[model samples]
Target: MKVIVEGLHSRGHQVSVVRSSDSWYIKETSPFYTSITLDIESGFGENFITTFVAQLLETQREGKSAWTRFKLEMEQAQKASELHENTCKMLEMLFENKEVIQSLHKAKYDLVLTDPAIPGGVILGHYLRLPLVFNVRWTSQGEGHLSIAPSPLSYVPMTGTELSDKMSFLQRLLNVIIFGFTEYQISQYVLPNYVCLIEKYLGPDTDYLSLFQAADLWLMRVDFVFEFPRPTMPNVVYMGGFQCKPAKPLPQHLEEFVQSSGEHGVIIMSLGTLIGELPHDLADEIAAAFAKLPQKVIWRYKGDRPATLGNNTLLVDWMPQSDLLGHPKIKLFVAHGGTNGVQEAIYHGVPILGLPLIFDQRDNLFRIEVRGAGKIIDIFTMNEDTFFQGIQEVLNEPSYKKNMQRLSRLHRDQPMKPLDTALFWIEFVMRHKGAAHLRTESYRLPWYSYHSVDVMLLLVGVVLIILGTFAALIRCLCSIVHADGTFRRKG
Candidate 1:
């Protein structure tokens, strides 16, 4: 969103950012945009997330048994519900605040630009009858494409399954089961709170899912280079790696560290912002692995200093990740497969040694691995030897680098910059007062109608009726012939 804001501000657009008062990132003042701070708690506050993530990590470390998996799923659902419930409370406050509502109405913004991962902005956009544009990869339910596009379970893998486009029969079955569970999660855990708000404020006829799928333009955060070939809607625009750019000069300390690595090159690791620390024993094993590596390691961790810390490894609370990835001395990336980090790695043509901890991290790394550009380490099962071997395989093998560089070429060869493409579509929506022409009305259709189940049932019924009539006609003709034969015999 900050990237989009910067782009729009550069193009002489006045932007107003609405954020929670407790937002960790968004500030009250900025040259780029005017900030509107709401006095409400966003359920996804830092404390809530950090605590939740810690719990998840602990549960995962309990082993991959069915009970552990079930616990993890249930915990995730419970947290999702809590998050949505908090968002609903905020929405309720916003709706009740006449002053804020009036001000928003008077602003008359050209469009509502939002990440639909949380649907508050989506709902508000509909309430304002404004053109909606989503800067999206994930929605409140799951992947954005699953909601608006034709996703066949045969190939389009569900979020947590970590399967690719090509799958065996059993994999497809697993995909279907996962898909069912995902739908159940969304309906049971995520939607009810939003439903109440919709019915109370937007009227009973306004469907929550429709409000999301009804977006005039969906600036998708992925492209075919990173995603498998699948059915998509016209309104969905691919802007994968839009946030990625040419790297800037690194900080002097980091540059000096990279230079000191000499012929061995450097490897950097970060598990993104949420998982600041690992289980102490796990961290110690990772540290031990780094200790064995001749290549210098930079690990971004906010955990206790591992007992096995090596002189060759430098642990920091944060680093200029993209800058480091783009550096020529950098040999490999050890990442948790966050979208931003993955795209940047692709942009910089760096092979990954992925340590996927949670959510879509595994899937993201799986895509890279399938492309031969990366390898994944199961944090649960990985030890010092396995971890070191994974790193060595990525560093020692020339194919890893070659494959990643090829991907880099493909990503960079776009007709226009991804960000520019996104901007064009966004402006297109505004200029046209909405890209309704491109959006599908499929969201408005009933589930049966959308799948054409009704049409299929009608066709089947017609065929069955025709066959029945033909069978009856044949029986009647046979009877008549038999009666004639009997009469002739009697005469």
Candidate 2:
């Protein structure tokens, strides 16, 4: 969203950012956009997220049993529900505040641009009667595509299923089951609070899910190079690696370290922003694996120093991840499969050694692995030997690098930069007041109509009626012929 804001700002557009007062990342001041700081909680505080993630990791480590998975799903749904509840509370406050509502209306914003993972902004957009543009991958329901596009469960995998576009009977069954579970989660945990708020404020007829589907444009943070071939809509524009750019010169110390690796190249590891530290045993195992490698390692970690820490590894609280990935000396990325990291890796043509932690990480890595550009090591089952072997496989194999470079070429072959495309569509929406022409009316249809079950039933009914009429005519004609024959015989 910052990238979109920056692009819009650079294009001489005035931007106003709405944020919660307690937002950790969104600052109260920025040159690029004016801030509308709501005196409400963001629902996602740093500590809350950190603790939740930590608990998730612990649960994962326990085992991969059915009960364990069920527990994890329940916990995640509960947490997600709590988050949405807080978000609704915040929205309630905002909606009740006549001054804020008046100010928003008076601003005459052309559109509401929001990430619909939380639907507050979406509801607010409708209230303002502004065109909606979603900078989204995930919605409050599930993946943005699932809500808006035609996703056949036969091939298109659900989020946690980690299945690919190709599936056997069982895999497809699992896909449908997972989708059902996702719907259940949305109903039980995600929708109630939002539904209540919507009914109270936006009227009973304004469907919460429809608000998301009715967005004028979706700047999808997905590139087909990394994503599977699936059904899509014209209103969706892919801008997966929009944040990536050419590598700048590295800092002097980091440069020296890369150079020191000589011909062995360098391997960098980071588990993204959420999981700064792993369990001590896991950290030790990872450090031990890195020690076995000849390539110099740069690891972004916030945990205590590992007992098996070696001279080859560099530990930093944070690293310029894109810059490091873009560096020529970089060989393989040890990543947690965050979309940004995966897209950046694809942009840089670097193969991955995926240590997926949570959420879509596993699925993201699964995609890369399916494309033969990476390997996934189960973090729960991984030890020093397995981790080391995984790294070596990616580093030693030529195919991983070759495939990733192909993806890079494909990502780069576009006529316009992704960010530019996104910006153009955004401006196009503003120019047109909305892109209703591009959007499909499927959202307005009932479930049965959308799936054409009603049409199928109607067609069946017509066929049955025709067949019944034909059968009756044949039976009546046969009876009349028999009667005529009997009368002729008697005469």
Candidate 3:
């Protein structure tokens, strides 16, 4: 969103962003843009979501089987419903505050752009009757954001399975089960809650389902190189490296730190914006591991400064991540495997030592591992030995760096850059008045029709009818022959 807004504003377009006041990142915006902050204690909602994410991550770390994870997810769904209700209450507070609502919707904006995860924007888009566009920063499989292109259940893995296009028979069956369960949870638990909230807060006639389906464009933040081959819709645009750019020069102290490593390069460590603090024991373990490394460590520690920090390790609350990755002296990235972070590392051709913590991070690490550009170690399973070994493996193995460089080349070898592609699609939708023609007819088709199941059933019915008729004819002919033989015998 920051990149898109900056681009648009640079092109002389007015952009306004409505966001929660308690956003995790520092609030940064251009003077040409407008920012609207919701006045609410944002901690509860974010904490609730984080709790759910934690549950998932813990389950994965436990090495639980699929059935166990599924059962836990079902339980989690119930908790999610409660969280949804609480989130609705928070939104209700905003809706009740007429001053904020008026400020948000007063100007007739040309388009209402939103992330699909955020329902407030979806509701507002419907209420204002504006052209809605989704800038989805994740996979386009679930959350009622069904792809127009038919995703084959047999091959395309479920959201978190980390499987490739090729699947065993059992794997495909599990995929079906997982996909069905996800849809069931969304329809039975999530969507209905959102509908009720919208009706209660927004108005009676506002249909969020329709608004979701009415989206003019879906600018998903993934690329074909990273994703398995799947059918895609015209309305969907891939903008994987939109957040990535040419790196700027690092500050002198940071530069000296990298150069001071001599032959050994520096490693940049971060857990992304969500997990601000690590458990003290884990932090100490990390500190101990970094202490043994020859490479200089630039660690982003959000919690109380670790007492075990060695002379080679530098701790800070934040660092310019992209710029640091682009440095020649940087050899490895120890990160949470968030999409943007992984993409930036790929853009800069830096090998990763991934400790994926939650959500899409696990899947992103799976991709990095499959591509041979990195290694994945469970956060819970990390000890001084394993963590240090993982770092050494990536840094020592030339294959990791070679694969990352190859990927970076492929990522940069596009017809148009990701930002330009995004801008072009955005303007294309604007010029063509929503680009309705780009949408696929699959959206209008029933599930059976979309997958050709109905047609197959019709074919089966016709074959059955022909077989039944042939059997009846043969039976009648045999009976006639017997009757004629009996009549000849009587004569």
Candidate 4:
């Protein structure tokens, strides 16, 4: 199949890509340059200014040799952390390279797939008028914010909503002075000033919203085991855990260590790439928790350890996460609840204790918690006491493990793997010229699209008012005319 995939390309099926790549050599480390040119964190098409700024904030403490690589990332993060500002700004490159992209789109492809992360995939998918699969790794990519948007304005970045449900009296009064009239106008007026750098540089594309609705199908990178709301749509399938590669072999010593741990098992601690830092005291408490447990701990700390150490605990800067999770001897997983880590935990059937820091971490862990497959430790309020106690509870109880195992079975019981499921749907669309008939009946409902509670109430109010007005007119006429003689109208 002439399939085209647009994503990190680090994993998943092979496909064409138009993303940013800059090589920075280690020896030449500076704000201007570096040794390795790794792909940008968000997606491909992010232009120079935004990429430079984002990289500035996302990096850890700068190395003396690195020469302000750390400083740049931090500075950029401060400037453009808001989603609307960040996304619209990052898409500048799309506007700049419009002609070239248009030419690329005209080229033939059997199938086109993209992530909502970079609306480019959606862009290319639509331009070609080809079969498109929305690879939604994040939950907010859905139509609504799913009940967690910080403010109504917050939805502007993700959903393009125009109003707030809970506009406070003070906020309304302040907005009158600040924004004049119409909340939508106010947000639109201010959005450009804050995040219009992207639009300024990238130019424009009018069809930005169509890419979302015109999807042929969607390949969700979420397992049913973890996502509790359960995709109510038929076309949206759960095959998130499927991947092309097999597990790499574990080191002999590592294998022996896991096997020797017995029923107590090994506890794996890892916070995925973005939020790897463990607060000083939390790390100590975690290490201490390991001391209390019979199970040996294999923690991927990724930073300098505290002065103390326990005999049974092992800490390293890196770990073979997938391989370790696949190990039969591992009993518990401590994760930051990133989508990838969540999928990995479920695939291996290991119970997870998620400590979410920011962004989708809270949403990701919330899903797992709601599904009854895992436990969560709030990063903001979590202390050594709660952390230690949570771990002990997960370890001591059998329910969490049993539930995880049950989910794993259901996940694996599918006749077709997730990757295969995605492949079939993609091909089906290609063969049928976007087999859109498969989209569910309910999604097409007027209620689904309109979301008109207030509108419905208004319609009822109009009918009642019209009826009441007619009744009043009839009564007035009857009072005015007395015994067929003309009379004054009733006041």
Q: Give the CA lDDT, 0 to 100, for residue 344 in model 3.
A: 96
lDDT of 3: 0.79
Instruction: List ranges where model 4 is wrong by over 4 Å.
Output: 1-14, 23-106, 127-130, 139-207, 244-249, 380-385, 438-491
What candidate 3 gets wrong by more than 4 Å, as runs, is 20-30, 37-79, 86-106, 139-147, 197-211
lDDT of 3 by residue, 344-398 (tens): 9999999999998765678888888999999999788778889888888998999
Question: How many steric overlaps are in each model, in order?
Answer: 0, 0, 0, 17
The collision pairs in model 3 are none
Give the worst 10-residue stretch by lDDT in candidate 1: 40-49
lDDT of 1 by residue, 1-491 (tens): 89999999998889999999888877789999999999888877788989998898989999989798889999989998998998999999999999999999999999999999988899889888999999999999899998799899999999888899999999999999989988998889998888779999899998888888889999999999999899998999999999998889999998999999999999999999888899899999999999998989999999899999999999999999998999999999999999999999999999999988877888899999999999998989999999999999999999999999999999999799999999988888888999989988888889899889999999999999999999999999999999999999999
Q: Give the better candidate number (2 or 4) by lDDT.
A: 2
Each candidate structure's TM-score, on Cα atoms with residue i matched to residue i, is 0.97, 0.98, 0.88, 0.67
For model 1, what is the error of residue 399's alpha carbon versus the real structure, in angstroms, after optimal superposition? 1.2
Could you tell me the lDDT of residue 454 within candidate 1? Answer: 100
TM-score of 4: 0.67
Give the CA lDDT, 0 to 100, for residue 388 in model 1. 91
Stretch of 10 with least lDDT, candidate 2: 190-199
For all candidates in order, the CA lDDT equals 0.92, 0.92, 0.79, 0.58
lDDT of 2: 0.92
Cα lDDT of model 2 by residue, 1-491, tens digit: 88889889999999999999888888889999999999888679898899999899989889989998899999999999999999999999999999998999999998999999888889899888899999999998989898899999998989998898989999999999999999999999987888778999989898888888899999999989989999999999999899889888889999999999999999999999888898899999999989988999999999999999999999999899999999999999999999999999999999999988888899999999999999999989999999999998899999999999999999999899999999999999999999999999988999999889999999999999999999999999999999999999999
